[model samples]
Structure formats: structure tokens, C-alpha cells
Target chain A: MNAPRVIDVRGLRYRYPDGTLALDGVDFHLCAGECVALFGANGSGKTTFALHLNGLLVGEGSVRVCGVPLAASVSAGDLALVRSKVGLVFQDSDDQLFLPTVLEDVAFGPANLGLTPEEAAARAKVALEQTGMAGALHRAPYHLSSGEKRRVALAGVLAMQPEVLVLDEPTTALDPPGQRDLIALLRTLPQAKLLVTHDTSFAAALATRAVFFERGRVAGEGGLPEIVNRFHWSR
Target chain B: MRSAARETWIVERWSRGSSPLHSLDARAKLAALAVYLLAIASTSAWTQAAVAGYAVILSAALAASRLPVPALLARAALILPFSATFALITWLSGDATRALALVEKSFLSGLAVLVVIAATPLTDLARALEAFRVPRSLVLVIQFLYRYLFVVADQAHRMRMAAACRQGIRRNARPRFHAAAGAVGVLFARSWERADGIYRAMAARGFHGTFPALAPTRFRTVDGVFLCGFALAALAVRLML
Candidate 1:
């Protein structure tokens, strides 16, 4: 259709090494700048589904992001380029933050993108500033509180300036203030966002489109209000 | 936020100086430390007076470099276990003179390592390895290991605390161990998963195994002067003995 889809998935299936069928025949589509929420209870394939979008977990069928296939036919350099376009923020901030300091972690993406040191540092500064983490640049990620670590982790991805942002359980284990801060920040990023979360209230607050996942299949998909109404009716 | 106490401890104990001692090329310092050790080790057994004088001069140089004296001494003291064994062997040989000399030599050699670390930053040490043309992969592994070792340690400490809190019965030895083992397993699994995430993030960012130097260190006049002084002082003490 019009310039292909930003994210296109077809017949995606996956099983863990332990033979757990984490995802089965999940299909999804997102246009530019849409905010979509992936909702499910634990083990409902939400995280597995999100992992597929970025080529982090390979599955049975095709996954094309910005029209490039997620396979070996795509050269390594090109795959990296594709990855740069798709930013994935993991569920735990500790996993995202391995660097000694916030600035170094935030700059990690740009530095790997072949930007000059100066350019990378500037981008990192801007991204941290965006996340309201500028003053904490020199501080270690381990030292930060749970909310601050989350914000810094987001800043690290934000520095790369990816076109699509995929967040897995972005609000788990946060206090009310931390959760509110994350929600407020999510609303302001100018990219198509795929939010994978178990928090129903959080999905209601941020997602325009909702995809309900159950035992690996796409149970249903619709706009937020439509999905909410349908969910209530079915209940 | 790192507590003020931890931050202060790091800056005081971990941060090296920018003085003459700090700037010696890593290779040169490594060589110097080697020669210093050899000299100390080979000295005659009755050289306590000479060794004491050597220690004073070396400690003074450490002080001159602005490294906190008490912290440096405390760290040096921690290494006494390995040194004590060497000293013990020499003493057990039934030569009183040799025993005193061996203890002094071991202590001084340990002090020499402390001097190098106090003088050179860890990054410079990496650069020193690079200077010797160490494989990029090896250097990268070492750099990552150094960077993440502290992180993993901190993560382990927190997990330990959480396990302690949950076990409730402070004295239930069986459940406490069960909790501890489970926590260790979780930490291992979590770190493994985090390693994967870190690799993906690095790949997405374009890390190709080699770490690019953000800032290049330059060898300057101070580097040369420090090496010469250290060598000369060491020589004067050893020869005069």
C-alpha cells in the first residue's frame, strides 16, 4: 500500500529453548506515529511479541520493519541500521543499565552508530536533558532509585533517536510518582510506540490502539475505547 | 544516588593522581615495578635497615602524589596474607637474617603494586595493554569485566538483602540457606538475561567488539621525570645497602 507499513508481522511463531510455546501466530501492524498497547496477563505472549518486532527473538514467519526482512539476507550493517531505527527498552532498568554512568550509557547508542565522539556526547546530553536526567549524568546507574533508573534507561534509548520505541513492562515496580513520570514522558516522544504492559490502567492512560493477547494468539485488536467496551461486554 | 560515604571512599581510595607518578607510561611502570621487585627479592637477608629506608622513600613518593596515605596503607595491609606466607617460608628455613629480609622484601614488593595502581588509572592501564599491542578482543573483555564486575557485585548485594528480608525467621538455618540458594540462582539467571540485553543494545548502537577511545592520553614531560626519579631513588637505596 502507501509506502508499505512501518511495522508488519505475519504468521510469527516462537517457542523457548525449554519448549514453552511463548507465542503462536501473532500478527500486528502499525502506521507511523501510532501509540499501541499490547495487553495481556503474564505468559500471554506480550513480551515475546514485542521481542519479535525488533528482531531480538526470531520466529517462524516473516517480520518486516520499515520494509526490511529480519533475516540473514539483510547484511549485518543494514541490520544494525534497522535496529537503530527500532529502540527497545526492556522491562527492568537494571538490564538496560550496565554502564558506569548515565551519560556513558545514554551515549552508548550514538557511539555505536558511528557518530563522532563529540556528536555522540552532544546527543547523549540532549537525550538525558529530555528525560530530565541531565544533572545525574555522572552518577552510576546502580545508585539511582528505581524510577530514576527507568528514566535513565529511557534516555539511553532516546539518545539513539529511533523511529519506533518498544517498551516492555515500562511501568512495573514503580511508585505512583515514578509511574506518572514515565507516563508523562511517554506521551511526549514523537515516534510510533509499542508498549507491552500488564497494567490495564497504564494501557488506558497511554494507548490509542489496544491489542489483547491470550496464550500467544492475537485475541483481538481495536481502538482503546472499542477494546475496553468489548472487554467489559465479554466479562 | 551513591551515598556520600561510598562516593567519598571511591574518590579517596580509587582515584589516582595526575602527578608525575600518575603519568608514567604503563609499560615503563610495569618494567620499573619488576626491577624494583627483583632488587628487593635478591637483597641479602640482613638488610632490614636498608629495606626500612626504601619503604620510607616509597611511601613518601606515594604521599607526594596526593593519594590518601591512610587509604593506601590500609589497602597494602590487606595483601599481607600472600606476603605473610612467603615471609613464613623464609623464617621456617632457620635463617633469622633471611626471614627479616624476606618479610621486608615481600612487604615492599606489595607496596610497589599499590604505587602503580595509585599512580595509574584503570583506563590508562588498559591503554598500557593496548600499547603492548594486546589483542583488541582480550582488551575489550578485560575492560568489560572491569566495568561490570562492580555492577554485578552491587546487584548481588541487593539480592542478598532482599533474600534476608523475605526469610523472616532470622535463625531458620534451613530456609535461610534455601532462600540464599534461590537468590543466587535468580541472580545468575537475571545476569545472563541482562547480558543478552546488553549485547543487543550494543549491537543496535554499533559496537563491533572494539571499544573506541573517547579521549586519548598523551605522554608528556612529567611521565619521563617520574620514571627517572623512581628508578634513581630505588637504585640509590638498593646500592647503598
Candidate 2:
């Protein structure tokens, strides 16, 4: 049985305001229940491409998230719908966890989705439980360790219950044990994931397929071993 | 990094305390603060007594809050240097009473504000302002500023550390100032870029031009009583003094 595609992008291209072409006619997709690791160097357009998933950057592209073709004139309501369906955990947890408390930050997405305060709280609680951050719900984000902050950031996204999870640099500052814990946590989650990272071992652990970005295009794609070997990604 | 972390910690610590003052609704606390500030600002015949009364009220509130008294006073005293400048000028101009009163009122006012802040979280304070019909744009700016103050501070701290590591016992003081000025410009630019990225992340997660209220506020009868009681106390100080 062929699994349905969760994200389908054809002929995607993006350019920065300074006339730098970031993504040059790239194509990408994520199948349901499959985790795909996007391997790329800095300025390779992985992040720029991920930003387009939820209408954050409306670049020139044919992108569809859960069958929603992003419109150029996406309204706030429209973008919100897209965002709720596609949870993108940014590389910097500081950017994601902006609210005063962990629970409030987790509740942010659902609250934006027009959930009542009680419903948002409920969702936040469940997400915190899922990410093992239930105890840190009342704590300030800055007071948290890097690992805790990353988990809380994930909980914030998970609270929205998005079908697609796109995490950028999931293990940047995490210690070995923290990465193990995160990997274990990610294994339990059922959402299709798009992981943008240069961490080969991390990508190999969970990613069913891997894609490499080079010079604004997909340079290679296949099984993790094939992609890593083809791109010479690891030192 | 340590100082920035410590500064944020102090506020976080005070705000977490579950005192009666903390139990008061944010709007009620704000209303009480407004009344107290107004009473202090009024130039009345009994200005001296009002100032004394304000001090008494703030001290009582501080005691109820159960915050560290010395810490609270020190934080309040931070306002003194600026106020002292004006007070010193007033003293030189020959009105010793005015100078004394200026210092007295400013100290009391600072203490009063610190008391309210200790009792309420910054987010709650922003919510209170929103409830009071302040401009939504202004409240949004306040919320963003309060949230990102630490992020920017952390970034600045990291940059400072990098500069220190590169300094290696510098001797050129003039070049040091130039480097410091250059760093300031870079800091602001980086802050702007970070702000832009944060806004995009927010938009991606469906930030629809408003910060979602994590908990809705309901003004209870007790909140009403708290408001009335505090307002009346300030009013009594202004009038019966």
C-alpha cells in the first residue's frame, strides 16, 4: 500500500530580498508516518524551504501542506490554519518559547487556533506530558536548561497536534544523554517529521529517508546510508 | 550572562510568591497603583502628610507581599540618583522643603511601583493594561519587549564574552571605546534580525495579531473589594491628611 504524501513541493524556488537565490527549483515531499532528514550546509536553503511550509515566506513555489496549496495572499486566518497543520520547531528554542511560562508557550499554538483557554490548557498539559516537560510547565523558559528548553519547545509545537513536524537542528546544544532522550521521545510520536540537521547519527536514528541540499537544490536523496555516502556529509 | 540571568531571576522569584498581594486581581492591583500614584502626585496643602501616608501604605503592602525588604528597598533606591539630581537642584535654589519633599515623594513612588511589580507578573501587568483599554498596539509592543528582553540580553552577554576573550589585556583605551561602539551597532542589528525571525516563527505558529490569553480573567467580588479598599486608602491619605 502506498502511503499518502503529507507535504508535496514541485519546482520550488525562493530568493532573498538582496537578490540572492536561496532555493533554485527544488522539489521535496514527506510521506505520511515517515521521517525525512534534510541534510544541508549553511545557506543551503533547507531552513528557507522549511519556512515556506506554513506560509511564513511566500516564495515562488508550488507547495502543498496536507493538501492545502498556499496562496500568495494568505490571510491571517489562512496562515493560521496552515500553521496549525504544520508545526515547525525552529532551531533556536528561545525563538519558539517566548511566553512567560512553559505551559503558556505550549498553549500558544492551540490558543491561536481559537481553542478556548481551558481547551488550550488541556492540550498544553498533554503535550507537556508527551515531551516529559509536565514538571516544568510553570517555570520560565530562560530558567530551563538547554535540554529542557528544547523539550518545552517541542511540547509547544506538539500541543497544536500538527500532522507534520518539521524540526530544525533538533540536537544542536543537547548533551549525548539529552539527544538520546529526545530521540526516544521522537520515536514515540506518530507525526510525519521533516528534520533539518547536519547531525548524521541523529538523522540515521529516526529518518527513514534522507535528502541533501546543495546550492539551492536537492543534490541527492535515498536511504540514510546512500544519502550520507553520496554527499560525503560526515567527517 | 550572570547579571542578566540574576536580574530576570529576582523578578521571577518575587512574581512566583503566593502572597495576598499576589492573590489580588491584576486590574485591581493596577487600579490601586493608579490611585496611589495620583495621590502622591497631587500638590496639596498636606503634601507632607500625604507623602508620609504614602510611605506607610507602601510599607504595609511590602510587608504583606513578604518580599525581601532590603532587596525591595535597594531596587527602589535605584530611582534615587535621578530624582536626587533634581532634588539637589531644588536644594541649591533655596527651597529645602521642596527638595526634601521631592526626594521623599520620589522614593515613596518608586517603592510603591516596586511593590506592585513584585506582586504581579509582567504578563499579568500587560493583561491588566489591556483590560484598562490601553491601545492594543502598545500592549503588544510591551508584551514582545518584556518577552525578548532576556533574549537580547543573552545575546549581548555572549557577544561581550567573545569580546573579552579576544581582548587579552588590551592597552588601547581609545580603540576599546570604538570597538565597544561598533559592538553596540552590531548588537542592535543582530537584535533586529532576531526579532524578525521570532516574528516569522510566531506567524508560522498562527500568531493572529494578538497574544492568546493563557488564562482568562474574571473580576470577582473580592477583586472589587480589593480595588475599593486600596483606592479608598490612597484617597483617605490624600484628603484626611
Candidate 3:
């Protein structure tokens, strides 16, 4: 039996205030426990489409996460529920880890979900331990190395217990060993993941399939090697 | 940028220490600071002895904090340029006594604030402010400003380096001034985009308005005792001396 769809989007279109059409009729979906890589150029709207999954960007499209459709007028409760279900690890860890300490930053998401302090801390501890960052719990975010910051940022999202993990350029600042460790870590996670990246090798290491985006649309979709070859995505 | 990072690290390290002052509740420390400031501000310029008493009290608190006295004093002296300007104005108005008092009070106030901040982590201090009914929005602004100050400074440093490399050792003031103006504009735009990115991240994590604390602060009997004792001591110096 096939897994249920965790994320479903169709005909998504978005335009910036300056009249730039970033996402034009994009279609995408992710099945439960499947890892999919989004291959595209810099301005191909992968990030913008990823943003739509969590209701961060409301565009002209239908986005449903874990069976809940994103309403045209997003209520606070609906937005919170969708956000808790789709955790987005942004490109820059500095932008994601805004709290003072590692533990606090990780627990921020859970606490926002209305958990008690002790409960949120427990969740955060589990997430940090899973990300191999339990030792840096009390350290400040700025004091951390780039790899550690990335792990803590991942932990922050994981603490929310999202069903779908959307990582935008996760390998932006990681060294070779850091990337290897990240691949190992991400492979262990069972959540459906959507990786928006240009790193073909990194994508092949974990992603089972891939989609190619071009000019705000889905240009192609197939096996990782097939999509990479078709788009010349490798650097 | 490196100096700013070093200074911030030093203060953060001091806050994490196991000194008695560091162990005290941030609320108690903030209350004591408020009392001390009020004492200093209410003192008459002619009451030079009271001003000295305030200094002595602040010195005792600084000693209790277990931080480096000389370093903190030097840091507090950074306020002198601004205070000295006002002091000069007062002196020119034929109020030398008031002028001296102004400088002394400002220095003492700055030192007292530094002592408290050096002993308490900013997170705990922000929690203390929330507990005291400070507006959540204002507290969040202060916390975000402090957290991102280094990031912004580092960006500015990188921009300067890039501009220097492109300029190739050009030392002309006119060109340098134009480059600086352009850099400022770019920095502002980058900061604005960064702030937007931060908001999106926050929204993705379910942040509504107020930041929830991982560990809620508890006001203990010891904290109460420290607040009362410090406030009484400050009041005594202000009134009796």
C-alpha cells in the first residue's frame, strides 16, 4: 500500500509587490515518509513554493498539509495548526535561531504550541539530543559554530513535531564533514521531507525522487539522477 | 566587530558565573537598581556627602557582583562624553556644584545598570521585565535588538572590507564618504530583509506575539530579602547621609 499524501499543492502562483511573478502555477505533493528534492535555479520559486506549504506565503493556489487545506482567510488557530504540522528550516540558521540559548531556541516552537515550560523543555531536549546538540543547550546561538547552529535550527523545528520538514539550502554553510553528518542525521528522520537545494550529490544521498523547477513552474519530475541530468543541476 | 563580540562574550560569561549576585533573581536586582537610581537622582547638588554615599553603596554592590571593578568602571565611563557636555553647560550657567553632581549621578547610574546586567543574563532580565508588567512588544524589540546587533555589525564589517578591496587603497575623503553613504543604504536594505526573514521564521515556528520562556522565573524568599535589604540601604544613604 502507498503512503498517504502529507503535502498537496496545485496551481500555486505568487507575485511580489514589485510585479515579479515568483511562483506561476506550480504543482507539487509529498507522500508520507518520502524525501523529495526540489532542483531549480536561484529564481525558480522553490523557496516561495516551500513557503506556501506552511502558510507563510498565501498565494493563488491550493495548499493542503496533512489533509488540512489552507483557507483563503487564515485564522490564528488554523495558521498555528498548519505551522506546527509543517516545520521549515530556513536557509540561514542565524535567521531561524533568534532566542538567547540553544535550548531556549529549540523550545520556542513547542512553547508556542502552548505546552508547559517543563513539557516544552522536555520536547526541546529530545529534539536537541536527536540532532546531537544536547551538549550545547545553554550556549548562546551566536557562540555556536556554523554546523552546530544548523543542527540547533533543525532541532528548533523538530521540537514542534512537524509531519513535513521543508529544508531550504540546508548545506549552505556546512563543511564536507558537516554535510556528511547532516545527511546521516536527516536519513534517520521518518518525516516527509522537501529539500530545496542545488546540491545534486547531497540530494541523491537522501532523496528518493526529485522535481525540477523552472521559471516558476514544475519543469520535470523523476528519479534523482534523471532529474539532475535533465536539468544539469550539478555544479 | 571583533571588539563588540569580545565585549558581549565577556559580559555573557560574567552573567553565567556562580557569584552571589548572579544567583539573585533578576527582579530583585532590577528593583534594587531602581531604588539606587532614585536615590542618586533625588540627592541635592549641595549634598556632596550624599553623592559620596551613593558611590560607596554602588561600589559595595559591584564588589558583591564579583566582576572586575576596574573594567566595569572603565565601561561605565563611556557615558562621560554625553554627561560631560551637560555638565559643561551647567558650569557655564554658573552652577558648578550642580554640574559636578550631574556627572557623578550619571556615572553612578550607568555603573549600577552595568553591575546588574553583568550579573544577570539578558533572557532572565527580559523575563523579569515581563513579570513586572512591561509591555511584551517593547521587551521583544529590546531582545531582538540585542540579539541581532552582532549580526548587523558583522555584516557592516564585511561590507567595509568588500568596499576597501574594490577601492584598492584609495584614501580620498570624498570617495570614501560616498562609499560610506552607499554602504549605509545597502546595510539598511539588508537589515530590513533580514528582519522580514526573521518574522517568517518566527511565524513558521508558531510564534504569535509574546515569546514563551523555557524556564519560568520564580520569586523566592531570598529574592525578597535581597530586594528589601538593598532598597533599605540605598534609602539610608540617600536620607541619612
What ordering of candidates by DockQ runs from best to worst? 3, 2, 1
Better of 2 and 3 by lDDT: 3
- In terms of docking quality, model 1 is acceptable
Candidate 3 lDDT over B1-241, as tens digits, reads 2378568877888888778899999999999999988888777733778877877788788878889889888888989999999999999999998898888889989989999999999999999998888988888889899899889989988997898789876778998898899999999999999999999999999989876642567889999998998899899988798
DockQ of candidate 2 compared with the true complex: 0.70
Query: What TM-score does chain B of candidate 1 reach?
Result: 0.78
TM-score, cand. 3: 0.91
Per-residue error for B160 in candidate 2, Å, reads 2.1
lDDT digits (tens) for residues A147-197 of candidate 2: 999999899899999999999999999999999999999999999999999
Which candidate has the top score in lDDT? 3
Model 1 ranges with Cα > 4 A deviation: A1-5, A136-139, A225-235, B1-13, B16-46, B85-89, B118-121, B154-190, B208-210, B213-215
Q: How good is the docking of model 2, by CAPRI class?
A: medium
Choose 1 or 2, whichever is better by TM-score. 2
Per-prediction DockQ, in order? Answer: 0.40, 0.70, 0.75
- List the lowest-lDDT window of 10 residues for candidate 2 chain A: A71-80
Note each model's CA RMSD in angstroms: 4.5, 2.6, 2.6
Residue A211 Cα positional deviation in candidate 3, in Å, after optimal superposition: 1.1
Candidate 1 has a TM-score of 0.82
lDDT per residue (tens digit) for residues A1-235 in model 1: 2434789988888999999999888889877888888877678888778777776678898888988888636677767777788888888777677665678788888888889888988999999999999999777676689889889888888888898989898888799888898889888988888988767678778888898888999888998778767766233
Please provide, for model 3 over A22-105, each residue's C-alpha lDDT reduced to its tens digit, 9 standing for 90 to 100.
999988889999999999888988898888999988998788888888967978888899999999999999999998889888
